[model samples]
Target: MHDYTIRAFVQGNAEFVGFDKYAEVFGSTTFPTALLNTAVFTLVSILFQYAAGLALAVFFRSGFRLSGVLRAMFLVPWLLPLIVSASTWAWMLSSENGIVNSVLGAFGVPQINWLTSPDTALLSVIVANIWLGIPFNLVILYSGLQNIPGELAEAASLDGAGAWKQFWSITFPLLRPVSAITLLLGLIYTLKVVDVIWVMTTGGPGNSTTTLAIWSYREAFGTGQPDFSPAAAVGNVLILIALVFGFLHLQLQHRQEGS
Candidate 1:
């Protein structure tokens, strides 16, 4: 990469800097915080999203009355545009008069700042991201469940297996391939998330919510004095992270197949 400055880039005189920009990114104080935030944001969002989505998928597997309608409703969050969803979350989590705090107020709880406060800002964004991710997980996992033979569960039921036991021994094991892919895709998606957090916190009250993606965007465009090289380095770091996980998934899948 090159040491790209706005003026130099315009004049086509940007100087090649090799990996200097990467060194700068690694050495910067914000790098540690951004890396940690990115990990927390990605991991937490995936865990909860998968759990909630799988639960909903299993619930809907019963094919209850109006199940189709209910399942479709869950897809609303996923179908909504990112900006719209983020803006809606921002409004709902507004500290002064948010609907969340309003409900808390009725229960004798004080109004807590959701987005503005550094302490809760990361949490707020994570919650919003998890909500956005659930529908995708539900759809995928539900399809996976369908591919699994119902006869397996039926046999387990005949053997006196409880619902929980059937799920753990039969349903879950059969769903591993699907679950792995779902989690991998979720990891990739969550790793590079920008719009939702950007709309809600813009990296925050004090960098508490700044992930690698936000840091990269901030360096390149969030401020008037754009520093393009370091931003590119940060973006590359995210790509490397995603690739590492992608490779790991492949390796594990290969081992599973070999076995």
Candidate 2:
């Protein structure tokens, strides 16, 4: 990673002329691609994580044999430092000597170049992120499930409501508030994620995994001449993205509260 002391003023012909780093950042080819990648990575990771977590929550709604023990075990991923998880996943997804490939080989599947290839690098990181995020979903949704009055399910059962009917008419409706909170928080957290992508791919393989967060980091820190102005511009764009999600989250929250 490149590092440089902050310069209060930019000095170059651009200063004398009419060159604008702000315009350059937006008009550049890189920004659009990074934005697109960030959106895809965040949406896909959160969607799958929520699905998997909610499933786990529902499964563990009622305490079972060793359920607490197992739930604690599930928390391992979320408890781990992002750096550790990212590094571990990097090792696991390595093309040749990776555990994932080895397991697939055992099943006679072809070895997939997970991190090295442009096509699969983003996907590999998303899968790791989903794993990292699932425990948060499970814990929050499980608490939400517990807060739900048991009588609701009892009444539904007495009314001969099937499992599906109970979930849709009862469980899912109640989960909406918690679900909204989870997704919004997930969005905020996922939007600025830089560690995993950086550690795994360094936004390489021809920039296939260069999300906005990574883009911002690279602009400020990766290049030889660290241009803080364009990097600041990119940071503002990230803030705008966050604001959009923040608005949606507030809307969801207000509607939930009003209901």
Stretch of 10 with least lDDT, candidate 1: 250-259
What is the model-wide C-alpha lDDT for candidate 2?
0.88
Question: lDDT at 94 for candidate 1?
Answer: 91
Q: After superposition, how far is residue 121 of candidate 1 from its true place, in Å?
A: 0.2
lDDT winner among the candidates?
A: 1
Clashing pairs in 1: none
Evaluated against the true structure, the overall lDDT of model 1 is 0.94
RMSD of each: 1.6, 3.5
Scored against the true structure, residue 108 in model 2 reaches a CA lDDT of 100
The worst-scoring run of ten residues by lDDT in candidate 2 lies at 10-19
Give candidate 2's error at residue 114 in angstroms: 0.4
Give per-residue CA lDDT, model 2, range 48-68, as digits (tens).
989999999998987799999
TM per prediction: 0.96, 0.90
- Where does model 1 exceed 4 Å of error? 249-259
Q: For candidate 1, report its TM-score.
A: 0.96
